[model samples]
Target chain A: MIQLEKIEKTYTAGTVQTPVLKGISFSIHAGEYVAIMGASGTGKSTLMHILGCLDKPTGGRYRLDDIDMVNLDDEALSHLRNGKIGFVFQQFHLLDRATALRNVMLPLIYAKEYPADAHQRAEKALTAVGLAERMSYKPNQLSGGQQQRVAIARALITDPAILLADEPTGNLDSKSGTEVMAIFQRLHRDGRTIILVTHDRNVADHARRVIVLKDGQVAEDRLVAQPRDAESELAAVVDEEVRP
Target chain B: MRTLRIAQEGARALAAHKLRTFFMMAGTIVGIAALTVIMAVGKGTEKKVMKRVNAFGTHAIMITAGGGKGFSPPQAGITTLRLEDAEAIRSQVQGIDVVAPFAVRRDSSTKAGSNQLQTIVMAVGADWHDAWEWYTTDGEPITAEDNSTMARVCLLGTLSASDLFGSQNAIGEDIQIGNVRFKVKGILEPRGTSPMGDEFDRRIVIPLTTGMRRVFNQDYITNIRVTVKDSRQIESIAKEIRQLLHERHHITPPRDDDFAIFSAADIAKMARGISGTLTYLLIALAGLSLLVGGIVLMNILLISVGERTKEIGLRRALGATQGDVFHQFLVESLSVTILGMVAGSVLGWVVSITLARLTQSPVVISWESFALAIGFALVVGVFFGVQPARRAAKLRPVDALR
Candidate 1:
C-alpha cells in the first residue's frame, strides 16, 4: 500500500526556481494495477521516482505500508528501495560486464536478510522471465528484449511489495512490448501491486485505473471497469504472425 | 559476508579494465622495488664495514700525518710523522709492541719485462709483518740490513705478483720500480680489503729507507702503525702515543690536532655512522617514490569514478550503501598495491643478490624493508583511494540516473 498527501518537488538551479511536481496526492491499495500517463515534461517520471522511494518530495507526507517515509533516514530509504519496492526502467540498466544471473542476484547482494539459496532463487527468477537458458549471457550479448527481460528478472528476484515500471515499453518493438505486457498482466493476476508510468495511451489501457498528468499536476483519475487483456492480445498477435 | 561480496565486486570491476589496472599497479611496483634495493644495499654496506673492522683486529692503532692537537688540521701539511717519532712511541709507550712506520705513494709505474702497470708503492720498516701479523708466504720478511743499506730488494702482494708475472715465479725475479731495478724477495699472502672497498693485496712494497731516500727522497714518514701487546690496552696505548706526539710537537689547548689516531673500534663505529646516514637518505628516496606512485593511483581512480557514475547509481538503486561503494574502491586499490608488493619484493631480492656478488659484500635484507614495503602499499591504498571513493559515495542516485 502507498499514500501521498500533497507531494511537491521543486528544483532550484543557480537562483532559478523550477517546480517539477506540484501538490500531487494519490494512494494505491494492495494488488492494485495503476497507470500514470503524461506528455513530455508533465512531471510523470518525477512522480514515479517519488512513489518508488528513489527520491524524496520536498514538501509532502509520504507513507508506505503505515511507515512514515518522510521521516525515514537515507539508510532506511535505501533499505525500502532495495526490499519494499522494485523498479524497471526503459533503459533496463543491467551492468554490461555482469551475466544475467549475476544481475538477477544483484538485489540479494545488498539485502539485509540475504537468502541462503541465492543461485536457485536467481535461476528461478530468470526462468520466470523465460531467460533461464540465457542466464549466463551479459547485457551486451543479449538483444534489447532479452536485456529487458533480464532486468525484469532482477526486479522480481527480490520479491518486493510493489513493482514500479517507468516507460517499460518505450524502447521495445511491438511484439516484445506485447510479451512484456503479458508478463505484467500475469504478475498482477498473481496479486502483485503494480505502478506503471507511460506516455502511451495504448499502454495505459492495460491498467485497471489511469491517472493523467498535465503540466505539474494530476489532470484526471479514471477507473477502467474492463481493462484490456494483455495475454489474449499477445496470443492474437502471435496467431497473426503465424498466419502472415 | 558483505565485505567479501564487495571485494569480489571490486575485483570484477577491475577486471573490466585489465590494462588500466596493471598500469596502476606498475607504479607501486617500482616504488616498492626501489625501497627494497636501497634497504638491502644500505644494510650490506653496514655489514661490510663492521666485518672489515673486526678483521683488522682491535690490537692495532693507526696514526696519520696531520690530525693532532696543534695549529694544523689533520692531514693538512707535507707530513710530520717520522721514523724517530715511531721509535720514540715504541720506547716510551708501555703497552706498545711492534711500531712499524710506513708511508704510501700512489701512481708509480712498475715494469717487469714487457708487462707494465700503474701501482701504489708502500714504504715499510722491517717490522711491518710483525705489526700487521700478515706474513710472506714464499721467501722471508724484510731484514735490518735491507733497511740500513736502502737495498733494492722488495716484496710483492699476491695480486701485484699475478699482474706483473702472470703464472711465473715472482721470487728472486727482477722488476723495475720508477726506472730503478729491484729484485723480488717474496710474494706476500692475500689480505682481503679495507672498509673503503680498496683491495689490500694490490700494492708494491719496498724497504722504508729505499722508498724514502731513493724514490720519494722525503725524510718524514706519512703514518705509523703500532701494535699493542694486549687488545684491552690498545685504546690506552693510542692515548699515550697521542700525548707524547702532542708534547713533542709543542701542541697545547685551543688548537686542532695535526694528527688523528683511530683504534679498530673507532674505525668500525665510523663506518656504521656513514652507512647510517646512507640508510636515511635511501628511506627518504623511497618515501618520495611512494608519494609519486600514490598520486598516479589517485588520478587514475578519479578517472574511474567519473567513468562509473552510471554504475554507481545503479548500485545505489540495488540497495548498496554509501559505505559499501567506499569499501569497494578502497579494497580495489589495496589489491593493486598488494599485487605490486609481492612482485617488487622478488625483483628487489634478485637485484640485491647480484649487487652483493659484484661488490663482494654480504646480501642483507632488513625486516624494516618488508614492513616498509607493505606499510607503504596500505597507506597509499587508503590515502589515494579515499578521495575517489568519497566522491563516488556522494553521488545522488536520482541525478546520477539521469
Candidate 2:
C-alpha cells in the first residue's frame, strides 16, 4: 500500500523556482494495477521517483506500509527501495557486461538478509518473465523487448511489494510490447501491485485503473469498465513488425 | 555479501577496460621498482664503503705528506716526511705500537708468462704486516733479513698473482718488474677496493731497502703507517704525532707544515659523505617517479569515474548506498596498487641484481625496504583514490541516470 498527501516538487535555477508537481495527492491500494498517463513536463516521472523511494518529496508526507518516508535519509530510503519496491525503466538499464542471470541476481546484493537460494530465486524470476532460455545472454545480445524482460526479472528478484515501471514498452515493437503487457497482466493476476507510467493510451489501457495527469495535477482517476487483456490482444499478432 | 559483490563488480569493471587499467598501474609499477632499486643500491654501496674502511684497520692512523683540507694519502717521492720522523712518532708518542715506512713507485709494469700489467711497487718494512693487520695467504711475508739484506724477494697481490700465474703457484716464481726479476715469496689475500676507489689487488710489495736501493733510488720514504696500542687512543695519538711532526720538521702554522695526519674515522667519514650524497640523489629521483605515477593514477581514475556515471546511477537505483559506490572505486584503485607492488617487488629485484652484476657491486635489498615500498604504495593508492571515489559517490541517482 502507498499513500501521498499533497506532494509538491519544484526545480530551481538561480532566482526562479519552477514547480513540477503542484500539491498532487493520490494513493494506490495493495495488489492494484494502476497506470499514470501524462505528457512531457506533467511530472509523472518525478511522481514515479517519489513512489519508488528513489527520491524524496519536496513538501508532503509519503507513507508506504504505514511508515513515513519523507524524513528518511538516502541510506534508509535505499533500504526501503531495496526491500519494498522494484523499478523498470524505458531504457532497461541492465548492466552490459553482466549476463541476464547476474542482472537478475543484482538486487539481492543489497538485501540486508540475503537469501541462501539467491541464484534459484533469480532463475525463477527470469523463468516467470519467459527468459529462462536466454538468462546467460548479455543485454547487448538481447532484443529491446528481451532486455526489458530481463530488467523486469531483475526487478522481480527482490520479491518487492510494489513494481514501478516508467514506460516499460516505449522502446519495443507492438508485438514485443504486447508480450511484456501480458507478463504485467499475469503479475497483477497473481496479486502483485503494479504502477505503470506511460504516454501511450494503448499501453495505459492494459491496466485496470488509470490516472491521467494534466498541468501537474490529476485530471481524471477512474477504473476501466472492462480492461483490455494483453493476451487476447497478442493473439491477433502480425509478423510485419518483427524486432530487427 | 555486499562487500564481496562490490569487489567483484569493481574487478569486472576494471577487466572491461584492460588498457586503461594497465596504464593506470604502470605508473605504480615503475615507481615502486625504481624505489626498490635505489634502496638496494644505497645499502649495497654503504656496505661496500664500510668494507673498504675496515680494510684499513680501525686502530691505525697515517701521516701523509703535502695535503690541504682532506687527508692526503702517501704517494711516491713526497719528501716532506722522513724515516726519522716515523722513528720519533714511534718512540716519543705514547700508545704507539709499530710504525712501517713505505717507499713507493707507481706505474711499474710487470710481466709474468704472457700477462703484462701496470702495478704499484711499494717497498715496506717488516712491520708492514703488523701495522696494516695484513698477512700472506701463502708462504711468508717480507722478513727483517729481507729488509736488512735488500733481497730480491717480493709478495704478489692476489689479483696480480692470478693475472700472471693463471692458477699456477706464484710462490718461488720470478716476475719481471722493469729489468729486475724478483722471486715471489708469498701472495697477499684479496682485499678488493679501497674507499678512495683504488684497487688493492693490483699491487706488489717489496722491501723498503730494495725500493730505496734499486727501484726509485729515493732515500726518503713516501708515508708512514702507524698502529696504536689502544684503538680508542688514535685521536690523542694523532694530536701528539702532529705536534711532533711540526716540531721535528721545524715548521709553524701559516708557514705550511706540508704534512697531514689522518685517523681511520677521517677516511670512513669521507667515504660516507660520497655514498650519502649519491644515496640522497638516487632517492630523490625515485620519489619524483612515484609522484608522477601517483598523478597519473589520479587523473585516470577521475576520467574513469566520469565515464561510469551511468553505471553508477544504475547501481544506486539498484539500492546501492553512497558508501557502497565510494567503497567500490576505492577497492578498484587499491587492487591495482597491490598488484603492482607484488609485481614490482620481483621486477625490481631482478633489475637491481642485473645492475649490480654489471657494475660489479653488491646489491642488498632488506625486508624493511620491501615493506616500506609496499606501505608507500598503499598510501598512494588511498591518497589518489579518495577524490575520484568521493566524486562518484556524491553523484545523484536522478542526475546520473540521465
Candidate 3:
C-alpha cells in the first residue's frame, strides 16, 4: 500500500522558486496496477522520484507499507528503497560490463544480509523474464527488448512490494514494446503491485487504472472499463508479421 | 565482511581496466624501487666505512712523512720524521697511549730457498704491535731486546709466509731481504686488505734497530703511529701533534710542512667519499617520485570517479551507502600501491645485485628496507586516495543518475 497526502515539491534556483508538484495527493492499495500519466514538465518524473524514495518532497507526507519515508535519512531511505521499491528506467540502466545474471544480482549485494543463494536467485529471476539462455550476455549484446527484460528481471530479484516503471517501452520497437507490455500484464495478473508512469495513452491503456496529471495537479482519476490486454496485442502483432 | 566484499568490487573494477590500473601503479613502482636501492646502497656504504675505520685503527693516528692533503701512504726517502719525534709525541701529548716510529721500503727483493719476490719491508718498534693492534698469530713477537740487540730477525705476514715457504712452516725459517739473511721469528695475523686497496698480509716486518743499523742504513723514520687512550680524543691529539711538529720543525703559515697526519675519522671520511652526497641525491629522487606518483594516482582516481559516475549512481540506487563508495575507491588505491611495492622490491633486488656484481661494492638487502617500503606505500596510497574517494562519496544519487 502507498499513500501521498498533498505532496509539494519546489525547485530553488538563486532568486526563483519553480513549483513542480503542487499539493498533489493520491493512494493505491496492494496488488493494484496503476498508471500515472502526464506530459513533459507536468511533474510525472518528479512524482515518480518521490514515489521511489530517491528524493524527498519539499512539504508533504508520503507513506509506504505503513511507514513514513519523509522522516528517514538518506541511508535509511536507501535501505527502504532496496527492500520495498523496484525501479525500471526508460534507459534500462544495466551495468554494461556485467552480464545479465550479474545485473540481476546487483540489488542483493547491497542487502544488509547477503543471501547465500544469491546466484541461484539471480538465475531464477532471469529465467522468469525469459532470459534463461542469455544469462551470460552483456547489455550491449542483448536486443533492446531483451535488455529491458533484463532490467525487469533485476527489478524483480529483490522481491520488492512495488514495481515502479518509468516509460518501460520508451526506447523499444513496437513489437518489442508489446512483448514488454505483455510481461508487465503477466506480472500484474500474478498479483504484483505495478505503477506504470508514462506520457502515452496507449501505455496507460495497458493498466487497470489511470491517474492523469495536468499542470502539476491530478486532473482525472478513473477505473478503466476494459483494459487493453498486452498478451493478446503481442499475439496479434506476431500474427500480422507472419501474414506479411 | 561487507567492507571486504566492497573492496573485492574495487579490485574487480581494477582488474576489468588493467591498463588503467597499471598506469596508476607506475609511479609507486619507480618510487619504491629507488627507495629500496637507496637503502641497500646506503647500508652497504656504511658497512664499508666501518670496515675501513676498523682496519685503520679507531684510536690510532698516523703522522706520515712528507706533506699531503689526502690520506696517502708515507712518501719514500723523507728524512725529516724521526724516532725523536715519536718520543716527543709519547712524552708531550696528554692522552698518549702508544707511540711507535716505523719506516717502510717498497719493492725490497726477498728470497727463501729458490723462491724470490719483491715486496714491502717495514721496520717497527716493539710498541708497533700494540699501536697497530696486530700481533703475531704463530710465534714470538718482536721484543724490546730484539731492537736493543739489533737482532737479525723478522716477522712474516701470512701471505708473505705462504708465498715464500709454500705450505711449509715459515716460523724459524731463514729469509733473505736485500742481502741480509733474517730468521722468520713469527707469522703475523692475517689482515685482509688496506684502505688504499693493497694487500695488508703481503708485507715483511723487522726490528727498527736492525733495519736502520744493518739493512736500511737510515736514522730517519717514515711514520709515527700514535694511539690515544680514548678514540674520541684522537682528532684533538692529532691536531696537537701537528702543532708540536710545526713548532719543532720551525714551520709556519704559507710554508708546507714535511709531515701529514691522518686519524680514524679521516680514514672514515675517505672511505665514505662521495657516497653520502650520492645517498642524499637518491633519497631526494625517491621522495620526488613518490610525491609526483601520488599526485598522478590521485588525478587518475578522480578522473575514474568522474567516468564511473553512472556506475556509482546505479550502485547508490541499488542501496550502496556513501561510505561504501568511499571505501571501494580507497581499496583500489591501496591495492595498486601494495602490488607495486611487491614488484618494485623484486626490481630493486635485481638492480642492487647487478650493481654489486658490476661495481664489486657491497649492497646490503635488508628487511628493514622492505618494511620501510611497505610503510611508504601505505602512506602514499592512503594520502592520495582520500580526496578522490571523498569526491566520489559527495555525489548525490539524484544528480549522478542524471
Best by lDDT: 3
Q: How high is each candidate's interface RMSD, in Å?
A: 1.1, 1.1, 1.1
Ranked by lDDT from best down, the candidates are 3, 2, 1
In every candidate, how many clashes are there?
A: 11, 0, 0
DockQ (Cα-based) for each candidate: 0.52, 0.58, 0.66
> Lowest-lDDT window of 10 residues in candidate 3 chain A?
A106-115
Residue-level lDDT for B306 in candidate 1: 89
| Predictions in order: lDDT | 0.85, 0.86, 0.92
DockQ of 1: 0.52
Candidate order (TM-score): 3, 2, 1
Which 10-residue span in candidate 2 chain A carries the lowest summed lDDT?
A235-244
Window of ten residues with lowest summed lDDT in model 2 chain B: B68-77
- iRMSD, model 1, in Å: 1.1
lDDT of 3 by residue, A1-244 (tens): 9999999999999989999999899999999999999999999999998999888999989999999999999889889888888889888989888899989988887788888999999999889889999999999999999999999999998999999999999999998898899999999999999999999999999999999998889999999899999889888888888995
Regions more than 4 Å wrong, model 2: A238-244, B58-60, B66-75, B87-131, B135-219, B226-282
TM-score of every candidate: 0.75, 0.82, 0.96
B247-328 per-residue lDDT for model 3 (tens digits): 9899998999889999999999999999999999999999999899999999999999999898888788777888888999
Error of 2 at B79 (Å): 2.8
Per residue, candidate 1 scores C-alpha lDDT tens digits across B1-402 of 877888889988888888988887887888898889888987787677767876575578888787643212224245677778888998898977889898777777998999997977888888988888878999877888899999998889999999999999999999999978999998887888755566678878899999888887789887788888898887778899989999987789778666778778677776676667877887787778778888888899999988888888888887888888888898888888888787888888888889888988676888898998899889888988899889988888887677
Alpha-carbon shift of residue B399 in model 3 (angstroms): 1.1
By DockQ rank, best first, the candidates go 3, 2, 1
